[model samples]
Target: MTNNLPLTVKRSIELLGLIGLIAVMVIARDIIMPILMAFFISIVLLPIYRFLRNRKVPETLSIVLPILLVAVFVALIVWFFSHQIGILVKDFPQIKENVKQHIDSLSDWISRITNFDDKQQKAFIQDKSDDIMNMATSLAGGAALTLSGVFVFIGLLPIYIYLMLFYKDILLRFVFMWFKADDHPKVKEAIYETESIIKSYLIGLLIQITYMTILLGGILLLIGIKHALLIGVIFAILNLIPYVGALIGNLIGVLLTLTSSQELWPVVTVLGVIALVQFLDNNILMPRIVGSKVKINALFAILGVFIGGSIAGVSGMFLALPIVAVLKIIFDRTTMFKQWGILFGDERPAKSPMSFAKFRRKRNVEVKPGSEKG
Candidate 1:
């Protein structure tokens, strides 16, 4: 009955459905986020699960073993961060002294360049300090809340992954049942492509993180930057979030550098080194490791990152590209959503629809200057 609707009405309905879906996601984020995460993770671990099954491992054992391994990997990352943070804390007094020195120098420069003297600058800082303290307090409280939620999310993740793996066949059957027999082939193709994309993307990310850490950390250490490993690890992790991640990583790297040393050259060295590494990562490392088969255009990718972050915080940001890729797969396979698939893709047409080249090609002849219609 709805097939007879006007084109505008159909588009409006689609827009409304999209809004409804986003609303549902936001409302049930606490429950839905983990399930989505587990779904992607299960895809990443599917090969390991298959390997164990082929070796005659029990289904339960197969699932549990991979989850356990993932847990250990996560635990090791946490330990590394904790150890680095401990060392940072031990250097607190020196960092404080460095910060003081930098601030005095900055104040002196400002006083020399501008009419604002040191006393005025100190007074202005004092005036803003209370507001800064309040903001920090609120952020700390939010962090505490987020931490508890993270714990709950982590506890539920393994169980979700285990069930998804154990019941993979059932899930496959459900997906198949959603479409008619004639469409089963396309449906299967979409499923297979999604699995392949998720697996490759996630595994490539892991490899990217490892190499990024080593490259960034090693370069910084050789340059004698303090807390090089910590900076590397932080940047690698943050750099997971598409375009915005790199900028944030750079800012964090600079801040960390500033905290460690009073000398300006070390900070300059850190920035220059990060820029070089990022150049390598963007041009060489990522493209070669993570194939651009499912390339998302910059516009929607940034929008997805921000929307995901708003809805589900960091996890949303990290998952945005994969989610977009999966949706593109489904959209491309569906008749009603093919346009959306095109919108999400990075491909550019060789010529515009109304371009002279296209026009000449259509007419099978180029128009001479005097051949124009009056």
Candidate 2:
């Protein structure tokens, strides 16, 4: 029936379908997010699950063991953060004094540059501080609700992962049932590729986090930045959000540095180290470790981050790249969506339509006709 329609109408329908799909995702994000996150995590855990199964381990134990290991890993991280934060809390008076000193310095500089006196500046700051306190109060209320939702999400993840791994055969069959027998090979290929991509990407991220913490925290510690490990952990986790994450991480790093010390040199040092590490990570580490498997372009990657954040907040932002990569895989394999795959990809043509050669050829064509007329 759609084949009988005009091309424009067909395209319009596809666009509308895309919009509807996004709407559904946004509306049902809470239900979908945990399942989606668990699916990716299960893929990363597949090797361990398969290894245990191959060893003739009990089916139940195989699933439970990996999840136990993951839970223990998470517990260690929580312990580390709590310990670090407690130490930080001990320095609260000093940090408050440093902040006050920095604010006074800033206000004095502003007063020197502008006609506004210290009294006017203090009044302005007082007004803004009251607004900030009110905002923080509201955020505290919202944070309680968010915390409850997080617990529920976390509680469901292991169960979802267990079921996914246990009923993996049924899931494969369900997927295969969507297509004819003839297309089974391509479906199998996509499945294999997706598993490989997810495993590589997730494991690469773990490695990234470890080394980033060691590199950033170790250096900051040597330079005497208080709570250096805390800043490192915070940055490594936040840096998962692609382009925006690094910037936010840097900002946080600077703030931590400033709060910990009265000097400005540490803030500069933090920024410089972060910039250097980011350059190395972007150019060398990511390319070699994660590889070109996901090959998404920057434009779509940033757009995906924003769109995912709009739909599902931080988790969505972190998951955006892999999600786009998976979508690109499906789109490339399908007949109707190959163009979208190309759009998401990082591949560049040898020569664009607007290249110098094409421009020169058009000029030659015009000149040739004019020469003949003359």
Candidate 3:
């Protein structure tokens, strides 16, 4: 009992220490988050840096090229979507009217079924509508603030990326130096694995996004949907959030279609397009591209998304899984953090060859007088 008391006290102290660490992290999150994001972006872009260097490109040029490409790509997307965004903003009044009409129509149908008067129905709906609008406005304001922060980060990204890329080797050496000389080999292995995972995950995601965007855009166009490109791009970007993202995009698409076209068939067709794209992403694209790198289980992936959304909003949600995957890699490599790797790992058990005798011995129980032992 005395010995057990000491063990219990030690565990309580350990738990308190962990809680303190978590509190500190939460408090420092705002300052830490951007640097963490910068680190990850640098990791993701490292492959291109290495590839260019190997091809005898100047180190500075190597870093500049990929950064330029990413910048140009982002600029083109913003330019392409600027008009749609403006139209959407301008059409807010029309959208509100359409939404109100739909709600009134729905309320009427419900009232008819329930024998409620139109005034009662309208009152009920008006309250609900006000709540929804308030929530949406709050969300929109938050999103605007987040985008402003992203723009500020973007301004600094080139400098951060350039220095990180050019000095990657030195950075890696410093990391290795932080460990004992004998531990350098293991540190290098961990570094390589971390780099490989980030590069693979990012590049694969880019390809997946491009394919999904094209497929979704083509399908929407074929179905004669208005603002097909806009819808497709929006879906592609949101799809980065994993399961919930596509669903949200689908809801938005359906709402937009409902407002733009009164035809049920068109809405059904849009839903079908979303379903088909989801199927392709799940069965074909993800399995081939992201499966190898992101081996984290679905539950953790979803949890990560939710936590990230809570902390950093959409950008956090978009980055959650990749960050989790990177953390898993680091944990798996580091002796002290191996338990975290196990905690975050896929829950499936590995199959191993079993000896019949050992299995039988483990399962064996003393036979009772009337019991048969198998």
**Each model's TM-score, in the order given?**
0.93, 0.93, 0.80
Of candidate 1, the 10-residue stretch with the lowest lDDT total is: 365-374
**Candidate 1 or 3, higher TM-score?**
1
212-247 in candidate 2: lDDT tens per residue?
A: 899888888897878889998999989989999988
Please identify model 1 stretches exceeding 4 Å from their true place. 354-374
Q: How far is candidate 1 from the true structure (C-alpha RMSD, Å)?
A: 5.8
Which digits, one per residue and each the tens of the lDDT, describe model 1 over residues 1-374? 45798979988988999999999999999999999999999999999999999999998999999999999999999999999999999999999999899999999999989999988999998889988998998899889998999999999999999999989999999999988999999999999999999988999999999999999999999878999999999999999999889999999999899999988898789889889988898878888887766778789999999999999999999999999999999988886777788678765444454764563231223334432211
State how far residue 361 of model 3 sits from its true place (Å): 19
Model 2 residue 52 lDDT?
Answer: 98
Of 2 and 3, the candidate ahead on lDDT is: 2
Cand. 3 TM to true fold: 0.80
> What TM-score, to 2 decimals, does candidate 1 have?
0.93
Q: Could you tell me the lDDT of residue 140 within candidate 2?
A: 100
User: All predictions: root-mean-square deviation over Cα?
Assistant: 5.8, 6.9, 7.4
Off by over 4 Å in 3: 1-25, 86-101, 125-147, 350-374
53: Cα error in model 1, Å: 0.3
